[model samples]
Target: MVLLGCLVEAMHANYHGSYSSIQNRSSSIRVAHCMTGTPRTLYKEEVYTAYRHQVLDVLPGDLFVVLEHINKTEMIHGTRVRADNAIRYKSALKYLSPRIVEWISIGDSLGSIETRSGYAKWKRCFDHIQRTERINGMKYDFIVRTRPDLYFAKALPKPSKLPKDKILINPYYECVNDIPSGYDRKWAKNLDLCDLTNYGVSDLFAIVPRALAYPYMCVAYITDLPLAICGERAHQAECAIKATLHKANVTYEFWPFVVKIKHVS
Candidate 1:
């Protein structure tokens, strides 16, 4: 009887020891880069190539790419190029590789209401979050919202320093000397930080915790933006997003990142 009891105790200890070791192994931060929106003027091949090296290869977590299927023809470098949604979709799957948790393809048509395109873009991002959670049964610690048209020259800043209740955003270019003149310089400066004016936060890239990700992404659905803002789609989206965060009492941090726009003009 004593020998049997001793054997059970030894087995229990070994099992817990193994469990602890497994936990330790996976303690590294888990991040998810959610790339949303249409592939407009960007070259699908080159964009994915840079994404492979900059994001997938460098970042140490899963990727979820959500692309809208919009068949728009535009001139690229004075050459007419038909942006084929199907080809770009395939290219993403091929290049993103093993780190991709799922590639969500959403329809291109903006619904009955002819709202700004930014509304649709934000909606797609929200959909990706819901779909990813359903598939994995777990949420990512950090979520990055960015577009495909922008090319990253280096890996994104790690998310270990971000607070759970705050959203991290990329710094906007200074207004006085950065942007082409004629616009309100004071408004531009205010826009750089989260402010009440409708100038808008930088819409290029944002890193947020799971808690704030849902609210930030759902800004489109909850609010109806003004006509002036709607006219400027990107800026309107940024304003709405920042406003959402502000309402929720979620703070923000500005992190500077220099990226090239893959526009062939």
Candidate 2:
């Protein structure tokens, strides 16, 4: 196990080149973006034209993934596998495993169902990542949660540049996707973290350490984010995710990476 981990880590470091920053990371890391929300008809083409160049090519790992199963696709592995909706996924199958999920109707409000499903995607993706670790008897040093649709003008920061104990999030906007949600560290200071937590973390992307992966990925496991955040009944993402994080006492830092959710079509 130790030998396997060292080999992957060495390879990962080589990808970034030999530098002092290389010492900041101890093991191999996997970065991923989830393909979720409403799928566009031309999504596959966009992946090659935009996402691949702007996001994937810039990042260091091949297993880069988020959640959401597109088409009949499955998830995270130690090898290079692309999980997408109606897209072709892969060059290696030796470490790839498809996650079969059975869907059940929530009958909740449409927003609620969407919210739960989104978080479930994160949870399930991480589970698959962890499963891969077990199968190979090795663990990733870090895990990144992102969506494939975010248009990035610059490369997301590598895990070596980030702190392991803090869940790294983007600076929040007052209204993302026309919703009144976004997180601010200043506003959260010294207050009941959960009370102010309804002001959600920008879900654009997050960098998580292995220690905090469970709390970071289990947002779907919570029964009601709106109620938990501010006593409402239905609010889908950001603020809801904030409530879950604050409740878990998870610490976070806003990394200065700039990106926006762009329409694929």
Top-lDDT candidate index: 1
After the best TM-score superposition of candidate 2, give how far the Cα of residue 160 lies from its true spot, in angstroms: 2.6
RMSD of each: 13.5, 11.8
The 0-to-1 C-alpha lDDT of every candidate, in the order given, reads: 0.54, 0.47
Lowest summed lDDT window (length 10), candidate 2: 10-19
Q: Model 1, stretches more than 4 Å misplaced?
A: 1-27, 41-45, 73-83, 98-114, 176-198, 224-235
TM-scores, each model vs. reference: 0.65, 0.58
Candidate 2 residue-wise lDDT, 86-191, digit = tens = 3333311112221222221222222223354365556545545655556555655566676655665556554456677788776654422221122222232323
TM-score of candidate 1 relative to the true fold: 0.65
